[model samples]
Target chain A: MKNIIIASTSTIHGGEYLEYLLPELSKHFKNCKTILFIPYARPSGITHEEYTAKASLAFAKINIAVKGIHEFENATSAIENAEGIFTGGGSTFVLVNELYRNNIMTVLSQTIKKGTPYLGTSAGSVICGLSMQNTNDMPIVYPPSFQTTGVIPFNINAHYLDPDTQSKHMGETRETRIKEFHAYNTIPVLGLREGSWLDVKGSKILLKGNLSARLFRQNQVAEEIESETDVSYIK
Target chain B: MKNIIIASTSTIHGGEYLEYLLPELSKHFKNCKTILFIPYARPSGITHEEYTAKASLAFAKINIAVKGIHEFENATSAIENAEGIFTGGGSTFVLVNELYRNNIMTVLSQTIKKGTPYLGTSAGSVICGLSMQNTNDMPIVYPPSFQTTGVIPFNINAHYLDPDTQSKHMGETRETRIKEFHAYNTIPVLGLREGSWLDVKGSKILLKGNLSARLFRQNQVAEEIESETDVSYIK
Candidate 1:
């Protein structure tokens, strides 16, 4: 059976890194003694060691050891033997490019699907979907392809924000961007706001957190899916 | 000589389409009776005809006629022979994809460089730079390349917004995203806030509007350039 937690963001506003999700994550990875970390996204262009150390600190609080996949001689073998996997948030382009460059995308996906515990936040969560097309991150780098694991039938738009009525900015809102994605693709997209996540166990995928997620389907009006609702039927 | 007005956005918030730049555009396209419009960006996923109609309505105020490039038999010829060219705002990916697909990118760049008056807003404006890697739009569609015209020496982060101090959102700020772009690219990037624009005439590129634009150079601290400042020296 597969076990996964796809969070919209690793940290909430004004909170320490991964502080808000520590309790839930501790339970999620409770059985695992050690977890492999993928830090290729490099938010703010931090080095692999720096990002890995940050992850290790968070996982340490839960009594689980975290190791960066970059430290291994072979990424595939590292993932294959890891008790659990955790991919942190950053630039989805950077993360996807590294995944392709290292040729570990397939192995990583297979390992997770084969009952390895997994936790993905932001860019990590987006990769669990059909494609990274719906990500809000800037295209800092060009990935070979937008395709992803397809561990879930739909796409994930992490850190989704609602349109601010009082703002005077002319940029497209989150909903508009996802709507445009639907114009070019038939894949469903879930707007996962910060602090929200999906708890996927075996064949069941349930929405977790306090807020409702906006679900966008091709040619249909977007609607809010309440928390605790089963989102497996989204596709 | 190049006569170009690359604006951050076509319309300011609560303003009509192109309302903010009508006077400047009136002078920019004064000698041209008709301007070729590229509506490939298709904001809101509107049809080319519909988008052209919107542009036509705006240009009509300046006694100029508008025609979408899609109406022509050959996109290259349409751009090469155009008296003035205007590419409206929307998804940058869609616009760049169409430009490459129609094989008009080079011709368009050459036409503008040959002193044909040009006006680009939002996505159109970003294409005037080295690459579209700094765009805030979603990757609804993937272009063959991230490269753009390089008419300007640096990249343009169009419709740039400052960090909201009161917001509880955990998403990366515009500055952070641009910093990540610098990690992979050496090109300088100008964060053009809404209502700001660049007026390029021959070798001189002057910042227009009343706001200060944020300039990000590789490894250097980002600084603000005041309106009317010549930014051509950036590169």
Candidate 2:
């Protein structure tokens, strides 16, 4: 039994971090007094303490305490005993590197697999895939491997954006990048846009949010999957 | 004398491949009759032969014969004997991986440093730097290392774009992403916009083309350097 929230972003264009998803999160963590926060993906290279404190502020609104995983000397034991877990956003490379460097990939996955009430955003959501090959972040650091937790079965292209109709930029569009990803790997990639998320409860995974997500598989044209649709059958 | 042409992109918005730079390329190649093409980047994972043909068509416009590195029995020997060299655009990870896998990284750098006419666009141009950390391409595959030729003292963010001011996308802007890169690396990154390029001759590396490029340094505000400016002093 697994319960999880994989969000494309922690914040929307004009919203506060975790503000857009508080309603769902409140219900997801019902009666949960505290949650373990993993700040390995420090967005803009923010310190773990500062990132954790930021997450704490968001969780505080829901009356749930948030603690940084770094607080524990034995991180492995901390996960083993955690009732809930949350991984925040940052560079996926750093996040995955730290996970492998700490030797916590397997245990952390197991804890989440056992239904530890998990939540992930941006880079954090990316680690839920077969590999972090679809991350849009710069390769600021070299990771031990691009491999990540395979809990979600497919990879996620978080914060996915459509091609700007009026832009003059010649850089590859987000859709084009995902198509390139499919050219090499057989894995399906879910283009989760900001404000969109995957809500997983047991074997059911629903596309949650007001917006639709683009799904791309090897050799297939990308298509939008509407919200509220059960995507558990995707894998 | 490291002679090189590092282009931001092979194609500009609504322009044919190499169209915007054909005039510069004609002069860059001068009297050269043929050049070796490195098609390992293979945008959208096109086959070596297919990608090579595409390059041939573009080079033909300038009356230069194009040969794919893969067509030769020994790729290194091809580089060693190349009158001119061109690396095409695609996935930076794949390009770097292939360069290292074929054991051509060292020889390729040596050939360029020895004054062999060289051209690199996008992923190709990125490998001219000390590392491929600043590439905008997706990490569809992981290379053994992120190290590149180090031909230039800094990194290049190919197809550099300004943030969409009126947009609502929450994904990090190109500028913001580079800042994140600076957070971990001290190397300066030159944001080469589409239609812009670096013209390297001997010890001088000049920013060429019609538009200005962005220069980003660690812990500092990024600034725009006008076209034709000799940025060799950036180091």
Candidate 3:
């Protein structure tokens, strides 16, 4: 059975890092004394050490120890041995590149499938989907491929925003970008708003948290899936 | 001498398509009777013919005929012999993929260097840089390479926006996103605001329009460069 939590963001507005989700994460990452942290995303270009420290402090409240993957000599072995695993958010490109570079993308996926508890936020959460093609992050670095863990059937557009009716900005809205993605890809995409997460246990993926998620499928009207509904059949 | 107009956007807010830049474009492409338009970006997934028709409609106001590169049997030759060229905005990934697929990236670069009056908006202007790493568009498709025409010395963040102080969204701001880009790459980046553009004339790259553009270089604080100032020396 697979156990995972794919969150839209690590921090919500006016909240501390991972503060809003600590209660849920505590339950999600329970039964583990220590969890390995993958800090490759390095949001805002922070060093791996610095990013890991933040994750460590947040997990400390849950009485779970946190160790960065970089601390281990063998990253693949680190995932294989971690009681639980959490990949922090930042640049999805950088995270995917590092996962491929460290040769742990497959190992990590296997570890989670073997029933190790796993948590992902933002860029980290996006990788749980079919591909990184729907990510909103800039291509800070080029990865070998857009393929991800595919633990879930569809792709994720984390930190998804609704169109601002008052804004004068001419940039494409989140919905528009995902529609463009559907133009070339047939994969379904979930627009995961901040504070929302998917609770995956065994083969069931439930939409958790307060807000509804926007589900987009090829040639179909985008619909809002209510929280706590099973989205495992989205594909 | 190289002659190019790299605009931040093809359409400004509440304005007709290319309406704001018509006067400048009239003078920039004055001698050309017809210009080849590359509709690879295809905003909203419109067909090449439809996108080209939109461009044709816009350029007609300036009395310059427009033809899509897709209309030509030999895209390379079409770019090589074009009296002028215009690449419209859409998904950067798709445009770059089609450019490489069609094997016209280099030929287009060489033609623009050989002084065929050229114009680019958004994704098209982005490719004028060394790489397409700085675009805000989603990676709907994978390209052979992130490398693009080095017509401009540095990368470009087109349709650049300032941070919104009132937003409650937790997503990374445009400024934060660019800062993350500087972590792995040292290339300079210009945040061209909507309605603003870069006028590339030989060795001179001048900022045009009313607004100042944000310039980001590695290990340095981002600064705003006033319009009408020469930015060719950035790199």
Candidate 4:
């Protein structure tokens, strides 16, 4: 069975919550050899060695081999050869750009379709969505926006801080940003507050988080949602 | 028949496109009085008198009366009394913030629903969508994201410039930003270049602009479209 874990962070990195993810992730890859994907770490300008070293600390207790995408020229071979793939979070745009540029986006999409275990966090989590409309990043800095690999129908607003504090700094509020998102198109948006995630196994989607995810339909109020609720939020 | 004109700008006394809009605006309120809604002009920090004075110049030859939303205590009253409403664009987030905070979003929705000649420019045009996810502005600010009047189902990336100037400043390319948008959402984004307007009368949506609009769907290539081609782009 293909197990996909789209999370906000790895090992409470950056003070994010990871309590809800450890158990679930451990259960899915119990005996599998894990390969960590670190595309989102590009913004730190950290070399692959440094990036993977920080990530290894998160999975230190788990007895699994962890390798970064940079170790191999062809990411497809690494992803295909591994029992599971864990994508760490950083700048989703940057990650997606590299994936597209390296032609790994297509490879990853095909790998996930083949039932390979996929684990994503933050920017990694967003890559699982249809688009990144809900991201809290500067639009001027382009990341790969087009080909998300269709892991999920709607865009995931990763690291989504609710009751936004930046409203005074700029103009518009979080709700307004999502509304503007709706004005352009009809795809539903999942505002994933930090610590939240969606786990996809086979065809079933399981929500794992402390808070209820906010859902926005075109020209409608954003609805609060609890985890483990079955929903067809697309369109 | 209620007539509405949504535009990117109004003459700040004199600009290249003042003549084109002034005559049409005058005709929209030929027999009835006119009220120009200057919601997006909040950034100018100009007094209402100054703002109104600038708009009046556009109607100088036509001898038509013009006023801003401040002229009335309630925007609903101003909108109700006017035969036509011209929404001038400036900062989309600012306009949306005021509309959402003052609880005039519904009134605007009602006005548009009643076919009460609703005209919007730039940011104003953005308000017509289900949401503003496609806008070129930052998404950190919160306007009432869920409060757009739903003038249309798709979002508009207004003032959609080529990857010339902004690309140089930001590390990620324009195509990368747009592609990231597609990665996170399934909604079709319309990259409306300047001098473009979508005239909606009943069920028909007519695209009016000097250049072709760019349409993007999830996992699909961005396609350039001809104006007046009735395409079902929002998937």
Task: Please write out the lDDT profile of model 3 over residues A84-164, one tens digit for every residue.
Answer: 999999999999999999988898878888989999999999999889999998998999999999888899999989999
Q: Please give, for residues B25-89, the per-residue lDDT of candidate 4 as tens digits.
A: 66656765666555443432345566567666666667776778877887777777766676665
Better of 1 and 2 by TM-score: 1
DockQ of 1: 0.89
Q: Mind giving the per-residue lDDT tens digits that candidate 1 earns over B1-235?
A: 9999999999997899999899999999999999999999999899999999999999999899999999999999999889899999999999999999998888888888899999999999999998999999999998999999988889999999999989899999999999998889999999999999999999999999999999999999999999999999988
Candidate 2 lDDT over B1-235, as tens digits, reads 8889999999998899999999999999996899999999989779999999999999999899999999999999999999899999999998999999999999998899999999999999999999999999888988999999988999999999888788888888888888888878899999999999999999999999999999999989889999989999987
Error of 3 at A182 (Å): 0.6
Regions of candidate 1 where Cα sits further than 4 Å from its true position:
none
* Candidate 2 second chain TM: 0.98
The total number of steric clashes, by the backbone 3 Å criterion, in model 1 comes to 0
Sort by DockQ, top down from the best? 3, 1, 2, 4
Worst 10 residues of 3 chain A by lDDT: A104-113
Worst 10 residues of 2 chain A by lDDT: A164-173
Please tell me which model should have the higher lDDT, number 2 or number 3: 3
Better of 3 and 4 by lDDT: 3
CA shift of A145, model 1, Å: 0.4
Name the better of 1 and 4 by DockQ.
1
- The estimated TM-scores of all candidates read 0.99, 0.98, 0.99, 0.52
Candidate 4 chain B weakest ten by summed lDDT: B165-174
Tens-digit per-residue lDDT, A10-120, candidate 2: 999889989989999999989579999999988888999999999999999999999998999989998888878999988898899899988999898888889989999
